[model samples]
Target: MISQATIDTVFETARVEEVIGDFVHLKRAGSNFKGLSPFSDERSPSFMVSPAKGIWKDFSSGKGGNSVAFLMEHSHFTYPEAIRFLAKKYNIEIEETEQSDEDKLNTDVRESMYLVSEFAKKYFHDILLNSEEGKAIGLSYFKERGFTSDTIKKFSLGYSPETWDAFTKEALGKGYKMEFLESTGLTIAREDRPFDRFKSRVMFPIQSMSGRVLGFGGRILTNDKKSAKYLNSPESDIYHKSKVLYGIFQAKQSIAKLNNCFLVEGYTDVIQFNQAGIENVVASSGTALTPDQIRLINRLTKNITVLFDGDAAGLRASVRGIDLILEEGMNVKVCAFPDGEDPDSFARKTSYDDLVAYLDTNAKDFIQFKASLLMNDAKNDPVKKADLIRDMVTSISKIPDRIQREIYIQECSRIMDISEQVLTSTLAQLVQKDITEVGKKVKQDQKAFEVVKNESPVQGAKVDVLYRLERKIIEILLLYGNKTEEFEDVFLKTNEDGEIENVIERKEYKVYQRVYLSLQEDEVELANPLFRDIFNDLIQYFLQNENLEIEKYLMHLNSDFAQEVTDILMEDERVVLHNWEGQNIIPKTKSETIGQYVSETILTMRWYLVDKIIDELKNSVSNEPGSDNTESMSMAMDYYKLINSFSKKLGRVMSRYS
Candidate 1:
C-alpha cells in the first residue's frame, strides 16, 4: 500500500552493503566485500556484497538479489516489512492508499496477526510512557534496575495497568476486536468478558529481527508467594517460545562485529550485560534453548558463549541447550558465574574489564565443562563414567567440521581421563551410523524416483528434440535477445492452383527466421523456467507500450522476475568497464558486432540439426512407393547444400573468436 515514490526512495537508499552489513561481518574483497553466508554453515566466505551494483550474491546458496531480498532472507521479513524497514532506515515518509472494507476483511491472516501485534506493542508503549500508573510503576522499576531511559525506550518496555479492564477498554475503543486481542495474548477472555492479560506487570516487548513485536515478557512486581513471578505471551502465530530469542535485533550487529554472541537467561541479564559494555548479548528469557534459537544466533556469529548461573540446578538446566548449539556446528563455551552469583548480579558488581577478563580466563569448551561437571557424580562408578564419556563423544560428533570434532575429542579425552583412541573409535562408529543413515535416505530417494517414473511414460524422441531446441532458444534469449541486427528481405512468387500467387514482402534473417519458424512450425517455446515467464512478459510489454527502453523492460517485471532477469543479464563477465573514460565513446570495432557471431553460431547449429533429421527421413522413405533414384539423389544434394551454408555460417561465428 506504500506509494510508488516511497518504494523507489527505499530502493535507492537501501544499498546492499548497508543492509547485509547489519547482519554479516563483511571485509573488503577488492571492489566488493566478502562474508560467511548467513544461509548456510560454512567457515569460508562465500557471500559477496557489491556496493557498486547494489546487489549481493551468495555463491553457496545461489541466492542473489538487492537489499530488500537480504532482509527477506536473513531476517525473515515479509515484502512489506522489508520495504518498511528500508523506509525507516532511510527516513522515507510512507503514504498508503486506503483499502476498501472488503479488502481489509480479506487481508492475509498472518499479516493481520503481525498488524495486531504491532498495535499491541504501541498500546503498551503508550501506557508506560504516558499513563501515570505505568510511569510510576513500570518506568520506575526499570530505572531502578539500572536500565537507562534510552535502553528502556529502545526495547519498548512498558507497564500493564493493575485494573483488569484498562487495556481491553482502550483497545476496544480503538476498534480492535476482542478476538485479535485474545489471539495475540494481549487479553484473556472469559465467559462474555475480557481482561488485560498482563495487568500490573512490567512488560518486555519481544521483537523479531526486523523489529516487529512478536510477543512480550511481563514480570510481577508484588510479593505474592503463590503467584508465578514472571509470565510470557502464550505461543501465537508470531511468537514461538522455543524459536524466539530476546534482544537479537539490538545485539545482532554487535555480535557480527565481535564474531561472538553472549547467551544469557533473562531480560535483566541482557540489559545488565549491555549496561556493562558487552553489547553482543541476548537472553533466552529463561526458556529452554532450541535449535531454532541457536540457528538464529548462528546467522549472526558462529561462536557462542553461554553464561550460566553458578547454582548446580541452573547449570544442569542449561546443559541440554549446549548440545543443541553444538548440533548447529557452532563453537560454544560455558562461562559460569561465582558460586553465589548470577550474570545479572555479577555484571552489576564487577567492572566491565574485570568481568570480561574473568570470562576470558574461565570459559571452557562444552566437552571440558560437561566432563568436569559429571566427573564428581561419576566417581568410582565405571558404568556412570562410561555413560558420561559417551555423552561427551556424542556432543563432539554433532560438530560439522572434522578438524573441530577431532580437537573436541582430544579435549574430552584429556578432561575425562579417557583414552583418545577410545573417543576416536566412538566417533568412527557415529560416522558409520551417519553413512548408513545417508545410504538409507539415498535408497528411499531412488525408490521415490522409480515410483514417479512408473506413473508416467518416458518422452519420445520428437518430444526430446523439441525440448532441447526450446532450451537452446531460451539460452539465446537470455544471452543475446536484446542485440540488434540488419537482415535482407527476400520475396518470391509461387505457382498455386495453376495461377501465379504473390507472397507478402517481409524482411528476416537467420536469428529471427529461426526463432520465428520454430515457433510457427513446431509450436516450440523457450524452455528455461525463468526465461519462459520473462519472454511472455516481454511480448506483452511490447504490444501494450509504444515507448520502451531497457530500464522500462525491467520495470514491467515483478521484483522477483526483475531480479531473475538482472541476474541472468548481469552474470557474464562480458561488459568490462574499460579505461575509455578519457577517450571517445566509440571504438573502431563496435562492441555490438559481437551479436553477429552469436547469430552465425545459432544458424550453423540449426542447419546442422535440420540436415541430420532430413537425411534420416530421406533414408526412411527411399524404398517406399513413388520413390526414385533421382528423387533420392536430389534430397541428398539439398542436404549437401544446407551443410555448406551451415559451414560458411560456422566460419563467421569462429571468426569473432579468432
Candidate 2:
C-alpha cells in the first residue's frame, strides 16, 4: 500500500502538461494546451490539458481527469502503478507500507507480466554488456551495424546467450515466477523443463508510449536457413504487436515538437534515423500497417511521411498503407530512397542535413505518389488505365474530409486526363454503395428498447423527481461548494388563528456549510447511493480542510467514482470549448451565476420533498376507509401554499407536481 503523504507529494510535484507531454504532444491554446486526442482518431485537436486546474480532458472520447487519471487511462496502468510513474517522473520518493498476504494475492496478472518483461529487459541488457558470449557476439553484431554505445544504451539493447536455459535459470533464481515468464514469452515452458525464447539473438525492447517494457523483438545473428531472421514476443495481456509501434516512447516528444512522424519498417530503421539526429521516427516492426498503429501516431501528429526502401514490395506496402492513413483522416506523404537503399543504409550513408533535405524535397503527397506509381503499369492499355482510375477514386473516397476528397478528385481527374464529372460520379456511386451496406448492417443488428412492465407509475415518477433534484444538488455542491455567498433562508411560522406566515432571514455562509446544514436540518439524504456517498465525503473533507482541490480529491477516489466526477465536471467545459455559443446555442455558465444557481437548486429540492409528502398524503386519503383526514389535508395544503409562495419569490414555476 502507498502512504497518503507520498501520494499527496506525487500530486503536488507532477505537472499535468509535463506528464502528458511525454506521451502526447501538447501545443498552447489560450491558457491551456490542445493536442490530438490520444484516446481516439482525430485530425483537429480535441484533447486539452489545463495546468491551472491540474487536469486534462479528451473531448473526443469524453475522458478527463487529473495527471494520475490521465496516466491510468492512457497506459492502462493500475492506480499504484500510475502513482509510482508520476512519483518517479517528478523525482519524489515513495513511502510505502508493507503489503499483507492478501494484498500480495491480489496483484494483477497484467502487472505481473509487466514486471517480468521489465526484468527480462534488464537481464538481457546486462548480458550484452557484461557476459562473455554476449559481449563477443551480440555487442560485436551491434558494432558492425554502426550502432554507438550511447544508442545501444538509450534503446536498452540486449542479448540472450546461446545456452537453452541461461536466461530461464537466472530469472528463476531471482524469484520470478514461471507463469509470468511463460506468459510474457520469455521462457517456453515444456513438459519437463523450460528454456529461453530468444536464445543467441540480440534483443530490442519494445516499449509502450509510457516507456514500460511490453515485449521484445530479437534478431538472429546467424544465416542458418532453418531459423527465421527476426522473432517477436507472442501476444500477451500487456503487449499487442499490431497496436504498438517501435520507438514510440523515444520518438513521441520529437514527433509532437516537429508536428510530423516519419514511418519506417524495422527496429534498426528507427534507431538509425535517431542516430542521424532525426528523432521523430517510428517503425512498424516489419508488420503490415494497421489502423491501431496509425491512431497511435495520430495522437502525436496528423502528418505522417512514410519512408520506403527502393524495393518494389516495400513501395507496394506503402501504397496499401496510404488508404488506411486516409481512412483515419490523417495527411500522409511518401518518401523513397535511392535504388537499392533502405532507411538504415541510407541514413548511415547520408549526412544529417543532406538526409533531412532529401526527405523534404523528395516527399510526395500520397495522391500524387499513387497516381505516378499506377500510371507506369497502365501505360498504353485502356483497360488497365480504367482500372487505375477506379483504384485512385477508391483511395480518395477513404478520406473522411469532404473538401479533401473533392480536391483529390480534381487532382486525379487532371492526372488521368479524365473529366471531373466522370470521377465525381464514380466517387458518388462508391459512397452510396458504402452507405447502403452500412445501413443494411445497422438494420440487421439494431436492438429495441426493453421496457419494464412491472414498475408503478406514481412511484417511478416520485423517484425520478427526487433523483433529478438530488443530482442537481450534488452538482451544485461540487461546482460551488467552496464559495462564500449570501442566502435568503425562508422560515414559516403559524399565527394564533392557525394561518401561516413567512419569515425570511438573510445569512452569509459558505456553500458547503449551507448545503450541509440544510440537509441536516431537514433530515434529508440523497436518493442515489453514489451521489450520497460523494456528497458526504465532500462535506466532511470541506469541514476538515480550509481548501479543497478537486483534482487531488479525485486522486484518492476509486476508478468509477473518479470517472463519474470527471465526466460531470468536464461536460460544461467541453461544451464551451466546442463553441456552442458561437453557433447561437447558449449553455448555462455556472460560475458567473453560481450564487443564484445554488440557492435555487437547494430551494427546488426542498420544494420537491414537500410536494412528495403531499402526494403521499393525497394517495392515503383516496385509499383509506371512512376516517378524519381533515387535519392531514389541511397540513398538506398549507405546505403546498408555502412552497408555491417560495417558488414565486424565486421567480421559478413549480413544474414538478403540476
Error of 1 at 89 (Å): 2.2
lDDT of 1 by residue, 1-658 (tens): 7777777777766677878887787877546787778887676777777676666777778777777778877777777778888899888898797778996787666666677778777877888888998889888888788888887787788888999888889878888777778888989999977888888898888988767788989899999887689999999887899888899988989998899999999999898888888899999999889888887887788899999999888898899888788878788999988898988889888899998899899999887789778888899999999999998888888787899998888888788877999899999999789889999999999999999999989875654554455445544554445444554333456665666654554344434334555455635455557667776665555446553343335434687786775565434311222323236543343235645544554464466466656667566665668766686677777866766656664664321100
Give candidate 2's error at residue 282 in angstroms. 1.0
State the lDDT at 139 in candidate 2: 97
Quick one: best TM-score, which candidate? 2
What candidate 2 gets wrong by more than 4 Å, as runs, is: 27-36, 42-48, 57-62, 191-193, 447-468, 490-505, 580-589, 610-640, 652-657
Q: Cα deviation in Å at residue 535, candidate 2?
A: 1.9
- Clashing residue pairs for model 1: none
lDDT of 1: 0.76
Cα lDDT of model 2 by residue, 1-658, tens digit: 9999998888888889999998887877546788778887666778888887778888889898998888888999998999988888878888989999999999999989998899999999999999999999999999999999999999999999999999999988998899999999999999999999999999999999998999999999999889899999999899999999999999999998899999999999999999999999999999999999999998888899999998777797667988899899889999988789999999988899999999999999887887877788899999999999999999988898899999999999888899999999999998888889998877666532123323434365667777777777777777778889888877798989999997889889999998888889989988789888888888888888777787788867877777767766655556545666678887767778777888777787888788878888887775457788898899888988978876896797766563
RMSD of each: 7.0, 3.7
Q: List the residue pairs that clash in candidate 2.
A: none
lDDT computed for candidate 2? 0.87
Question: What do the candidate models score in CA lDDT, each in turn?
Answer: 0.76, 0.87
